[model samples]
Target: MSSAHALMLQGAARSARLLEETQAQWRASGDDLLLFAYGSLIWRPDFEVEQALPARVQGYHRVLRMRSRVNRGSPEAPGLVLALVSGGSCRGLVYRVARHDAEAVLTALWAREMPTGVYDPKWLVCDTPHGPVRALGFTLSRRSANWCGALSDSELLHIFQHARGRYGTTLDYLLRTVDGLRAHGIRDRELERQARLAAAHGLCTPTI
Candidate 1:
């Protein structure tokens, strides 16, 4: 066997293990499960949602600081994605899944968000319009290799202009997210600013 083929097999095996572990962990969490959507999940849950409401989670902020090497770009040229990082607060949507469907919903979520195991999924307290509740969310780990930290406006625009993957372009992801937030009367200045930068470069259409 060739060295390149062996490495490919190793990578596939690693991804399979990650998926299995994520499914097991989520299953053990409990029957009642809530998921917080702070990014693409807001617009595209792609899962069965029994109930969804506007919610705010403290001690975290939504920022485009993670690399999406598959959804929005390839391994050679990764695109950026949002993840909840420590500090501040974030307003988004909290979705409650039916107890019977918890396993399936979480399994799909893990498969979509944990392809690289870069996010740490946890249940956090969220203040919703109805009331406060505990919800599951994916947060970024500073220790993860995919963490992009902060980037300049120029860097952001460049990535938005060129990055594309199986899902779509990175710019499409950003614009759609801001649009989703707007529908909920949520204004994310940071994301809006990045969209404007991309629009100024003719990479993305202005949605704000």
Candidate 2:
């Protein structure tokens, strides 16, 4: 594997260790879980409860960072995919769930996000109203027809623009992300720029 990939694996390993250590806390919390969202989840929260205000964390960036050919709309129809961009910050939303209810919440989230198998679930640290919360989030699916390390702003914007999902319009996605990010006191230069563009141009993503 490439050094970057190896490093990611190592990071993921360390993250696993952290989770292993935190398992009890996770279980004791009535099955509470945190979710880190960058795309549609920024808006829908996948029918999960809005437990707290959104927040941000360093070390992970958002992009068209993955592939999807199975669950989402077909490429012939908007053809949206995920990108694996790094080295920048991402500003998005976060969700909190009671431990006992996590499975139901995440299952629904994964179903909606992985409709075309473009992403994988992961645990991410989130800045929460009460400090930090560990969230279960998803990255692009490893199994996909069109997934990549990078995508054009326009390309990603297209997915964002054509934001129709099981929930609401892509515009709702952009608006909620922008608003949530601002609410969290988190600011990503690129995301902010995009949000501005979305506002000026009437939302970068549109409902499918």
Per-model lDDT: 0.83, 0.53
Best by lDDT: 1
RMSD of each: 2.8, 8.1
Kindly list the per-residue Cα lDDT of model 2 for residues 19-120, writing each as its tens digit.
454454556656567666665565445464647556665666765344333333333434333332334445566666676676566556544554433344
TM-score of 2: 0.57
All candidates' TM-scores?
Answer: 0.87, 0.57
Candidate 1 per-residue lDDT over residues 40-81, each given as its tens digit = 998899988888999999999999889888889877778988
